[model samples]
Target: MTSTLVENHFRIGKLPHIWCPGCGHGIIMRSIAVAIDELGYDKNDVCVVSGIGCSSRAPGYMDFNTLHTLHGRALAYATGVKMANPDLKVIVITGDGDCAAIGGNHLIHASRRNIDITTVVFNNNIYGMTGGQYSPTTPTGEKGTTAPFGNIDRNFDLCNLAKGAGATYVARSTAYHANMVKQQVKAALENKGFSFVEAVSICPTYYGRKNKKGDAVSMMEYLKNSTVNVKAADKLPKEKLEGKFLVGEFYKSEEPEYTEEYKKIIDSFQKER
Candidate 1:
């Protein structure tokens, strides 16, 4: 079944990707492909844009109109693509560092506009591709090559950031939860306004070794045991939910999408002219 999915959705020539053994990015990438395949979207009408990072390599393997853009600028390019041809389905594949750090301003504005684009953030905590630096989403006190003495910075709750910035749809899942990740990606794609999905992936090669968090399988197990459903989370007290994280759809609303609103203004101006 997995082989069939890869054969159907990936570019055959692009096999043998560079991700490390047991790295979760491959799983997340496959989940995205599964979601797109399940939606039965026309390849010609699908635009996969990505920034410079390990996760950004996803668009290269995908069978779509793909753009491997500058570091931290995937969202900017995707916004232009969606605005230029509103009919196209634009999906931005970004990493935690690429999106939440360097391209953070773009993220905020895009969500505020409620642009009709689906953004998938692969949050592996550390910057896996760039020598294992601590990223904006890296957990506090977690050790990275850049933080050998343990990091003191606070991590970003990306789901909350998207929701607060006015994104109409937002969800989160881990690479270990393959089916849930696929479903979340599908829901993001179907939403008309801006949608954000955070896939908490594992970087066993770097993050695990540096932090002594065991191997890939153990990290995946941690994800499974540490996450609670948002619905169930609400019933728990703040202290009880201290160490655990919330997963599942965090927010959804039927707001007016930016492109549609722009079209209305253009139509009005044309009538006056």
Candidate 2:
């Protein structure tokens, strides 16, 4: 618990997280912890809420006040938590399946309402936890247990979805770029309105080998090559953009967050009383 990411913010007995040997969840978790530390959040002031999935296990491993909630309902719980205690920093960590599949409606409405919660989605393309299955965000042409012939369905463009839903901050990063992930998370925390971050992850056991992508290490390599920051990538040609994802902060704006705005209404009511 003494690494740069674990600096003075971790609680005891949460060490030795239980991710797979080649799993990317651990890397993203480290990024989150580091971001929280950089943002000067105390363990008591931050709450990590998660839905049922491998990513949901993240909160159990963190030292903060955490909530392991129902499947695909992390956003709903996070919205309630933020509304109840506007001063607390609420972070939602959910798997792609849990967030984009079962919990998709909540995700959209949460963004539309501009809740003050920060959402981090661990997207491994395929569902790694409840067996290797297909999630809504699974990339087209990727093979999963359910999609033996390869997935023909379209995948979500998470940044665009968030921006369209009215989130004030939206960004994307992968496990390969751990440093930038932490940086973006910190920025998301500082933003007043709803924030969404998509953390591209690798499931070596389920997603990597099945798709002939080799082990987890190789999957991370794929992420390293498949993504480009818009600022640096715009100079490249259309061919350069082919099959590559645009990362970095895609959008950010100043807007009224829902919870605090509701608090202002209550304050006005108190004055009238």
Task: For candidate 1, list the clashing residue pairs, or say none.
Answer: none
Instruction: For residues 1-273, write the lDDT of model 1, one tens digit per residue.
Output: 348878878887887899999999999999999899999998898999999999999999998899999999999999999999999999999999999999999899999999999999999998999899999998899999999999999999999999999999999999988899999999999999999999999999999999999999899999999999898998998888888998999999999999999999999999998
Among all windows of ten consecutive residues in candidate 1, which has the lowest summed lDDT? 1-10
lDDT of 2 by residue, 129-180 (tens): 7788888887899889999999999999888988999999999999998998
**In model 1, which regions exceed 4 Å deviation?**
237-240
For each candidate, give its TM-score against the true structure.
0.96, 0.96
Sliding window of 10 residues with minimal summed lDDT for model 2: 4-13
lDDT (CA) per prediction: 0.93, 0.89
**Model 2, position 18: C-alpha lDDT score:** 70
Best by lDDT: 1
